[model samples]
Target: MRIGVPKEIKIHESRVGLTPATVRELIANGHQVMVQENAGLPIDLGNDKYREAGAQIVDTPEEIFAQADLIVKVKEPQKSEIPLLREGQVIFTYLHLAPDPIQAKGLLNSGCIAIAYETVTDKSGGLPLLAPMSEVAGRMSIQAGAHALELNQGGRGILLGGVSGVPPAQVVVIGGGVVGTNAARIAMGMEAHVTLLEKSIPRLQQLDSLYGSRLNTIFSTTDALEEYVTTADLIIGSVLIPGGAAPKLVNREMVSRMKRGSVLVDVAIDQGGCFETSKPTTLADPIFTVDEVVHYCVSNMPGAVARTSTFALNNATLPFVLALANKGYRRALTDDQYFRDGLNVYRGHLTHAAVARDLGITHTDALNALI
Candidate 1:
């Protein structure tokens, strides 16, 4: 098998798909790995490092896309790269297709087998591949929100943790999943007043047990959201619905009532955002004001911390990458039901039910599509 790694072309995206260590492992497993020139250079993993790892360094994305059987990437294939895809070629990456019909249509027309990292599940029903990046984005939400709250940044100018005489800022985290949990933990660590709203009682109880008196765990309700959101100094929207678009929990009216200097950090922006006014922003220009509230909705928050993100992602995706390489996509996916859940598109067919339903495309069973 020939695997290709292309340098990410998204604005301010510096994360590479494969590291030198992962390339070396693929080579040792009898697979040929082609890496675009300087693909890892942004993260300090130079071409020399890839060369020493026995990877063929290609000068352009065209060469790798044209020759490699499997395309490994950190982000979704951009509009320009979509034309490079060939029939039956395998694309393994984070394909947030539900919200981006253009990308989905392109991939479907290209007749490529698309496996999304974000939808891949583990035996514990956890999103193993998406977990590492989620952890990173979750923690960074607070940091970004804090900065956005500064007066110069167009925020309310409230400090996250107040001084000895002042009261701390109110931080509200929506959702109790990986992203929300980490956000609450970091907010609490900063000595701010934190409230986490969750839809799951058991999960809330679990969080309550973990944080004890340090964090406020509330059962999510319309009224709860209305009350907390309007009063929060910094709000983190970390809601997710797997491969589907994130629910718009915060409406435009809710946002209008927020404090003038308040900040909103939507970690779920990659899945179309949980805020009604949310639009994808780049790290280059990460914030926009909606109803006087600053919104930090950068679609790729983890990309800002590329080095750590690449290594952490590699740790979770290596095994699955090797499986696809050694056993081929069919055998590897058929052998593991959890892994089969990652199959979003298979040679022109939409195979993931949630993504298909959300995108209003016809669904095909992954197993049937494999045949």
Candidate 2:
């Protein structure tokens, strides 16, 4: 199989789909890998590195997409790349189709196999591919929140870990999954008062037992969230419902309840955000003020640190990329239930229910495709 890795063209996106090491491994597995020139440049990986990995370096994304059997990418395909897709070709990437209608239309018309990393599930019901980036984004949420808390940044001018004679700032994290857990951990590490909210009683009990007196867990409700935000200095929205639009737990009316200049970091922005007023921002202009409350809703938060994100994302996606490339997506998915769940679109049909419901499209069983 011929696999291609294109340089990410999304505005301000720097992470590459495949790392040089992963390229080397794909070649070792008897697959031909094509990497566009400077594809890994944003991640500080040089053309010589890919060349040395026994991979061919192409000059343009057009060439890579036109010729490769499988296209591995770090983000969803942009508009320009849409027409370049060929029918029956395999595209493996983080296709956040739930919130993206335009891209969904193009992929469907192109008649290609689109497997989304965010939808893939593990035996334990964990999102395997989205986990690495979620962890990265979660940790960065607090880091960004901390920066946004600075007075110079139009924040409340409160320090997360307050000095002696002053109380530490309070942090409220929505959700208790990978993103929330990681955010809570970082906030706790900063010596801030952390409150984690979740709808799952089991998860709440688990977090409570795990953190003991160091953290506080709350059962999520409208009244509950409203009450917490009233005094929160940093609100981390890490809620994710998976393959669906994230519920807006924080509404515009509730925004007024937050302390003036407090920061709201929506880590779930990729899934359309859990805050009613949250809109996607870029790393270049990462934050914006809404009614005096700062909103950090950069959907690709992990892209800010491309090198680490590239390596970490590649580690989680490489095995599956190899799986689909070696045996073909249909055969490989037919053999692995986890991989099948990853199938969002196959040959123009919506195979993932979340994406289908999201776009109001029809859901086709992935197993039926094998026949």
Candidate 3:
């Protein structure tokens, strides 16, 4: 099988689909890895590194998509790349389709096999491919929020960890999944007053046991979120629903109530955002003010730290990539139920129920479709 690693085309997306090490692994498993020229530049992995690892470097994306049977990417394919997709080709990437009607429809028409990273599940209902980036995004949410709190950054100018006689800033994190937990951990480490709202009691208990006194864990309710968010200096939106669109936990009304100079970072922006006022922002101009509340909704939060993000993402995705290349997507999914769940679109049909429901389209069960 020929595996293609195209340079990510999404704006501000520096993470490459395959690292040099991943290329070497695939080559060792009797698969050819084709990497586009300068694909790993932003991640600090040069083309020479890939060549040394036995990956053939191609000059054009057209060459890669033309020859490679499996096309892997870090983000969803942009409009330009959509034309390069061919029928029966396997595209493995983080396709956040719920909010992207256009991309979803495009894939449906392409007759390509689309396996979404965010939809792949583990035995415990964990998203394998999305975890590393989620971790990076969660940790960075605090870092960015902390930086955004300065008066110059359109924030309250209050220090997150105050000096003696000065109280720390209050940070409210909605959702208690990977992003929320990591955000709370970072906030707690900074000595900020951190409150986490999660709908799951089991997850909350897990968080409570993990950070008994370090953080405040609360059962998330719309009323409670509205009541407390307005008083916060930093509000982190970290809600997720697998392949489904994110629920808007913070509305414009909620933002209007927030104090001037307060910052809201929506980590769930990739899934259509958890904040009503949230719109995808780029790193160049990563913020906007609505209702006097600073909003930071960079869709690819992990991309900000390219080297770290790329390596971490490779760690999680490499194994699956290897499986797809070695066993072929069908055999790989047939062998592992976890990988099977990754199948969003297969053989020209939308196999993921959530995706079908979102677009009001039809779908068959992935297992049945694969068979």
Candidate 4:
């Protein structure tokens, strides 16, 4: 198998699909890896390093896309890269297709087998691949929100951890999954008043047990969200629905009533955000004001911390990458139902049920599609 790693072209996205260590492992497994020139240079994994790891350094993305059987990427293929995809070629990356119909249509027309990292599951019903980045994004959400709360950043001029004379800022986290848990942990660490809301009673109880008196765990309800959101100084939206679009728990009316200078950080922005007012922002211009409330909705928050994020992501994704390389997509996917869940598109057919339902497209069972 010939695997390709392309430099991320998204604005301020410095992460690469494969690291030198990962390439070396793939080579040890008898797979040929082709990496775009300087794909890892931005993150300090230079071309010489890749060469030392037994990867062929291609000069352009076109060559990498044209020749490689399996294309591993950090982000979704951009519009320009979509045209280069060939029938039966594999694209393994984070394909947030539910909210982006253009990308979905492009993948379908290209006739490529697309596996989304975000949808892949583990035996524990966790998104193993998306977990690393989700953890990074969740932690960064608090940091970004704290910075955004500064008066100069157009925030409410409140300090996350206030001085003895002042009360600390109130931080509210929606969702108690990987993202939410991390967000609340960091917020609490910062000495801010923290509250977590979740729809799952079991999960809420679990969080309550874990945090004890340090964090307030609340059962999520329409009234609960509205009340907390309205009074929150820093609101972090970490809601997710697997491959489907994130539910809009915070509506425009709720946002309109938020206190001026307050900050809303939507860690779920990659899945179209749980906050109704969130539109994807870039690292170049990370935040914008809506209804006088600041919104930090950068779709790729982890990208800002590329070196740490890249290594973390590699650790989570390497096993799946090797599985696909060793047994080929068909055998590898068919052998593992969790891996099969990653199959969003198989040779032009939409195979992931949640994605299909979210996009209003027909879905083919992954097993049937592969056969």
lDDT of every predicted structure (CA atoms)? 0.97, 0.91, 0.91, 0.95
Better of 1 and 2 by lDDT: 1
Residues 38-70 of candidate 1 have per-residue lDDT tens digits of: 999988999999999999999999999999999
Q: Would you list the clashing residue pairs of candidate 2?
A: none
Question: TM-score of model 2 relative to the true fold?
Answer: 0.98
lDDT of 4: 0.95
> Which rank order by lDDT, best down to worst?
1, 4, 2, 3
Q: Give the CA lDDT, 0 to 100, for residue 133 in model 1.
A: 98
Per residue, candidate 2 scores C-alpha lDDT tens digits across 114-196 of: 98899999999999899999999999999999999999898999999898999999999999999999999999999999999
Model 1 superposed RMSD (Cα): 0.6
Q: What is the lDDT of residue 285 in candidate 4?
A: 99
- Number of the predicted model whose lDDT against the real structure is largest: 1
lDDT of 1: 0.97
- As a TM-score, model 4 comes out at 0.99
In candidate 4, what are the lDDT values of residues 84-187, reduced to their tens digit?
Answer: 99999999999999999999999999999999999999899999999999999989999999999999999989989998999999999999999999999999
Task: List, residue by residue over 1-371, the lDDT tens digit for candidate 3.
Answer: 99998998877888898889888999999999999999998667999999999999999999999998999998899998988999999999999998898998888888899999999999998998889899999999999999999999999999998989999999999999888988999999999999999989999999999999888888988888987798999999999988888998888898898999999999999899999999989887899999888999998888889899888988999889988988888899999999898899887788888878877888789999888
TM-score of each: 0.99, 0.98, 0.98, 0.99
Clashing pairs in 1: 156-261
